[model samples]
Target: MLRLHRLFAVFLLLAAALAAPAHAGKPYQYYAVGDPTDVVLPQPKKTSLVLMGGGPDVDAAFAWLIQKGGGGNFVVIRSRGTDAYNPYIYAMGGARSVETLVIPSREAANDPFVIERIRNAEELFIAGGDQSDYINFWQGTPVQAAIQELAGRRIPIGGTSAGLALMGRFGFAALNGSITSEAALADPFDKRMTLERGFLLLPELGSVITDAHFDTRDRLGRLVAFIARIVNDGWAGMARGIGVDVETALLVEDGKGTRVGAGSVTFLQSVGLPQVCQPKQPLTYLNLQGQRMSGGGSFDLRNWAGYGGATLPFTVSAEAGVLLTR
Candidate 1:
């Protein structure tokens, strides 16, 4: 009788464990339909990065990413979502390889299986979600290190919206919360203007900061604020910013970037450190240059020069108040 009772207790526990949701007790939820072990080995190719603002991805841009993915073994990383992109990726026609992993916690982001998949992936895409979730969960984990390895191997990597937010050397990580232009211009040191760095250090994006949904969100003021912070904080000698509008993407390869989509991509270069940038004060900077690029336009990241578009020069100052002039 005693033996039977013990057996019954063990069976109940097993059943309870089996009934639990897959990936429960971990930091994230992971769902994959394809085999991660069956990925094709890495190949030497020009690594590319596609930075999409917030919107529906242009077909041409995704087509470009699909081609770069090589084979069907593409991987998508997100904080929360299903493998919905798999069908679309498979339709783009490679080896029919697509896998999606939603990592919700630091533990899940560092899971051996998750890290291994990321390392093996020929192409990786970061889905649009809360950038703060990304920073909080992925930073300082083996997952973050694995991404750096992928970049080192020259594999294709890209992201949309919040995912795109982290691709730059300096990121508006939104750790505290989203900042507004009014708050930022009012006080360049607003607590909401959280920034983070060192997630992925790609060469082409050195000294660069990125913003998404540029025009739609009217983020120019805030991006300027971010650039001000970078320079004032001694994060870089002078900071450069790229703001991509909705339905737009900047396809970057080598040291050059080409813009594509319906909206525009703006580049802002800080001539030098701000003359007057302090906590609780508006910014006063001279000769902050800017250029706007449309579809089929190109820009040299190394030189900050534009092709196929007018490289307009501009200045920003906050003597009495903030003023941007071309």
Candidate 2:
């Protein structure tokens, strides 16, 4: 009986171990590139964020990130992607050292050693991948807490593609799986239009939701739907949805956001409640404001005003479904 009980205990342990995330059993690898010197700062500065739309990276935004890092100790966090960023960050980020951490699971996210690296970095970058993996593995875990702590400390953080999707207070999450513009427009509350909240509560970004590969993917229609949901669901009386085009970057710093790279960044603000936003029914929204910002243009996030560009009015509905500027 004693032997049988011992065997049962061992089986239980094995099962528990197997049930852990895929990366739990595997070790986290840190790839280092370039000079491993320290770029020291006399004092910590306010936090800055670099939100990149999917596509080729922008050099101007990367240069800004490098400057914010104080020229050293840059870190890249990702669930999927190669260590190719190590060299790129080391060079473009102007860092004394660049390291990449591939954290693929919640268990890995809880690892104290991994958290230590995140906390020590002067600048942190989240790489592109499926944001769903990020939501499933990182949400409510120590990993999420650690990133939030970084933000609280005013550390600079940046991401591209899937990385950008996770920056806003409200995220699409893709929990029900990725949705297309046509599909989302057809039914505002389709299973695919999964929205999530409370993952990030960054100031000025708390009332904002983000979408990537905007123009290239024709995601404006869906982004409008997301804003309507935010208002209709009471997440915020007024919600902000930011859509970034391919190869573009929106740099948020000192309460201001600027657009750079080859494409434009569109800002969509819901004026009031949706005319129609029910499950299985088409969406109808009126008087939505949009601003198309290109490189060299800036906007005040705190005031929700545009300086270098114009904010145009757009009206979207189920029947006509046309994206117009007034």
Candidate 3:
């Protein structure tokens, strides 16, 4: 009886190991939540994007993403997270398979297997993690090239929090750690406000910077500061910023954006240039043309205007370290 009990214990351990996520840290790691075999389901794929704020997940936005993917293979890429997204995404039912790849280094990001999975994915998601990791590991590598290729094919792409930060043409890399709205407004050129361009080319999002957890984190001042710095850096004549509220997402299809969840999405642009945007000084931007949108109606990303009555327009400015509005 003792030998039989020991044998049962070993069987249970083997079962637990097999049930765990596959692949562990040789170079990279991956966990499959649904069907293990690769599959290409015959469904009409559509090109779309989701920028989710950091907080609770938005169910409607995810359902829309799955619908856009056309019930095909879904691949999620991240640098610091585990396979937590796999089972969550797989159970959503539009994807035939859900795979999560935890790529922590440049070598892992450039792995041929990793690149191939991204290239073939019908829908790809970037999980919330440190944006700097994504930049350092994936930038200039075959992984980046593969993602650009997938974008060229117009497949669905989505990200939340740090993931959403990089969807715009201009991304806040967050290399030096996070900077609060107070810190950013106090000094527009704060060293922690590291923004990068050409990392990922989404022409539709040209000259745009995205901020997540907008309402909950009070990130409006930071977003405004980011735009001020963009014009200060001469990247573009005009800079645009998108701030998504917590527990909400901005779904971009074609050139229009549809807000999802309970919170609002704020869009802002520099009036022209900051009056006093020098280093070690507070930003003094005269006017920031802005619009706030709720869960209804479509906001045009092309003209940066709203169609229905669900939009509210406001103007904001910063003087010294304080943000003011009229």
Candidate 4:
């Protein structure tokens, strides 16, 4: 009887241990190309910006803009989605004036026609898909060069979902989800996830980073995780996570600053977080300051001025990245 009781106690202890939540080993790290606050007003001759809602029929709206902007002969680059060859082609309807280029893979990303269409295009749009694919395939190829050239010429470049993610100077690759979800809420210090370098290099835009499906999907947690990774790796003293809710878009100008369009954009500013040592253990360091500011709300990017000012929610030891939506 005594032996049986001891065995039962051991089994109970094991069960309790198994019931506890498992902790990730470490957190992911994300890097930026430049500072977020630095806004460069483009030359008047070449300045155009566009934003697309995640779930809405924007064909008519885009068509109208293209026609008005003298972009009757436009080009659409569809790199994302399952049907890569004709990704998001329907979004334009039969807008006969515009031409479409569906790049199925990284190999096709550098096709001469693709490059020519992108370079000559007055407006460029990237379809929604896994952003990491954009980074992996087009980061340093001729297609990327053409996109940059279009930007230099002052043409509008827009994206949605993964497309939106690639717009920022720095972008999250979604390498692993373990640390991403947890770190967004609190400081989960185990830096387990790995980030891809130079994935979204928009140097002219500075070190701006962007994310999609903000409030609707409750992405606050993952945004915080991104900030933690940036701070932990000494990438930046402060980081900003721009969370875009579904069916919304934020319009950003070179010098005029950011403006809200269809939906709200949540800005997650991380000032501090609890320090942790190992996985599954409570954080020791506390006294962290995190704040959520929205576009056109009390927190205005233009009003914030440089990295340091009263307009900002918290004092950033280092400049945070910028985030855009659409």
Best by lDDT: 3
Please write out the lDDT profile of model 1 over residues 219-239, one tens digit for every residue: 888888888889889888888
lDDT of 2 by residue, 172-192 (tens): 988888888777767878888
C-alpha TM-scores of all predictions: 0.88, 0.87, 0.94, 0.63
Candidate 1 regions with alpha-carbon error over 4 angstroms: 1-27, 33-37, 310-321
Q: What is the number of backbone collisions in each predicted candidate, taken in the order shown?
A: 4, 0, 0, 16
lDDT of every predicted structure (CA atoms):
0.80, 0.80, 0.85, 0.51
Please report, as a residue range, the 10-residue window in candidate 3 with the lowest summed lDDT: 38-47
lDDT of 4 by residue, 1-326 (tens): 99999999999999977653222121111111112122223333635444443655344446433543454334556554332212243344432234445565666776665575566555566767666667667778887888877677666666777777667655676545334444433334444444544443442334445677666565655555555666666666655556666666655445333434455655555455425423444323323333333345333343334222212333222112111221
- Tens-place lDDT per residue, model 3, 1-326, is 99999999999999988876565545888777666566665544445888899799898887888788786778899998788777787877878788888889998987888887887788888888899999989999998898888788888888899888998889899999999999999998889989998787774688799999899889999998999899988999998999999899888988789888889999998778789898999888878999999858899888989987657999999888799877
After best superposition, candidate 3 residue 72: deviation in angstroms? 0.9
Error of 3 at 67 (Å): 1.1
Q: How much is 149 displaced in model 4, in angstroms?
A: 1.8
RMSD of each: 5.2, 8.3, 1.9, 18.1
Name the top TM-score candidate. Answer: 3
Residue 115, model 2, lDDT: 85
Instruction: State residue 66's C-alpha deviation in candidate 1, in Å.
Output: 2.1
Candidate with better TM-score, 1 vs 4? 1
